[model samples]
Target: MGQESLQAFQHQVGDVLLRHRSFLDVSSKYQESNGRVNRAITKAVTECGCLRIEAGCQPFEEAIALSEMKNRFDTHLTGHLCDHCLDTVKEELGKNLFYMTALCNLLDIKVEEVIEKESKKLSTLGIFNLR
Candidate 1:
C-alpha cells in the first residue's frame, strides 16, 4: 500500500535477480538470453512449488528440477539453446510470478493478499478495464 514498501520490495527483488543472473557469479556464461535466466527461476518456483504443494517433490527440489527440465527442453528444441538465450519467452508468466514473489518478499506481503486484492478489483472494475 505504501510507495516506500513497494520500492523496497522492488529493490530486493532486483538484487536477488541480479545476483542469480549475474554473469560474474555464473561459471559457464550460459550463453542464454536474459529471458532464460528469468524463466529458469520462475519455472523452477512455480512447477516446483506446485509439486511441493501436491507432495510430489520437496520444496527445494521442485524449483531445481523445473530449471533442469526446462534447460533440457530448451537444449533439445530446434534452436540452439546452448546459445545461452534468456528463455523468457518459453514461460513469460513463470518469470512474472518470480518477480511478483520477490516483490512480495520485499514488501512482506502474502500471495493471498495479492489474490484477494486483484479479485476485488476485477469484480468491481472488470478485466477489460484492467481496473
Candidate 2:
C-alpha cells in the first residue's frame, strides 16, 4: 500500500487498539481473569507478530501459559517473589509497548498520541496510574 493508505490503516487499527485499551493494560487484567488474559495474549501475539506459532505446535493460550510458568519459576529462583512479579509486569508492559510503537512507526503513524489518549482513558477508569 502507499504511505497515505498505510497511515490511514494504522490510524484505524490504532483506534481499535485504544478502544480495547493498550496491550499492556490488557495484560494487567490477567490478575482479574485468566480468560481475558488469554484473549489479550492471543490478540497481542497475532497482531504484533512477535511470537511465532508453529503449524502443529501448542496453541497460543498454551504457549502463553507455558511462558508465564517459566517466568514464575525463574523469578522464584531469585527468591524475591513480589519484586519479581512487579518487574515482570513492567517488562511485559515495556515489551508490548515497544512492539506496538514499532508497528505504528512501520505504518507511518504517531504512536505517542495513541499512547497518551489510551493512558488518559485508562486513568479515568481507575485501572492504570500513569504518574
Candidate 3:
C-alpha cells in the first residue's frame, strides 16, 4: 500500500469510529493495546511454548565493518509462532495499530508522514540509528 492508503485509513478511523473519540481515551486505549501486544508475545513464549527468547548482550566487534554487522546480530528468538499463536499475535497487533492510528487521528497527524520520516531517518543514520 502507498501513503494515500495509510492516510485514508486514518481518515476512515476518525470518521467511522464512535467510541474513544477523546484524545485521553484514545491515548489510554493505545497504551492498553500496546500492553496487549506484549502480553500476546509473552504468552506465546511461556504458555504456548511455541517460542523461546534466549536474549543476552549481543556480541560486538569494533573491527567488523558496518556492512557485515547484520550477520553477527541475533534476534534470540528460537522458534516461529504456530498457527494459533500467529493469529492471536496478529489480532493483537491489529488492535494496537487501530488505537495508534486513532491516536494519530486525534492529534491531526498522518501515519504515513510519520512512517516516511522514520524511514528517512533510518536510511540516513543506518547503524547509528540506535534504538
Q: Which candidate is the best by TM-score?
A: 3
Give the runs in model 1 whose Cα sits over 4 Å from its true position.
Answer: 1-90, 127-131
lDDT of 1 by residue, 1-131 (tens): 46566556556555666555533333223323345656554454455432111223323344554435533332212322221233433555445556555546545676556877987887877634421
Off by over 4 Å in 3: none
* lDDT, candidate 3, 22-87, per-residue tens: 888888888999999999999999999999999999999999988788899999999999999999
Q: Which regions in candidate 2 have their CA more than 4 angstroms from the true location?
A: 1-81, 116-131
After aligning candidate 2 to the native by TM-score, how far in Å is the CA of 119 from where it should be? 6.5
Residues 1-119 of candidate 2: C-alpha lDDT, one tens digit per residue: 45565457556655655443555554454333444444444544455444334443322354544325433332112122244344544566555554554456445657656766876
The candidate maximizing lDDT is: 3
Ranking by TM-score: 3, 1, 2
What TM-score does candidate 3 reach?
0.92
Backbone clashes for every candidate come to 12, 0, 0
Ten contiguous residues minimizing lDDT sum, candidate 2: 72-81
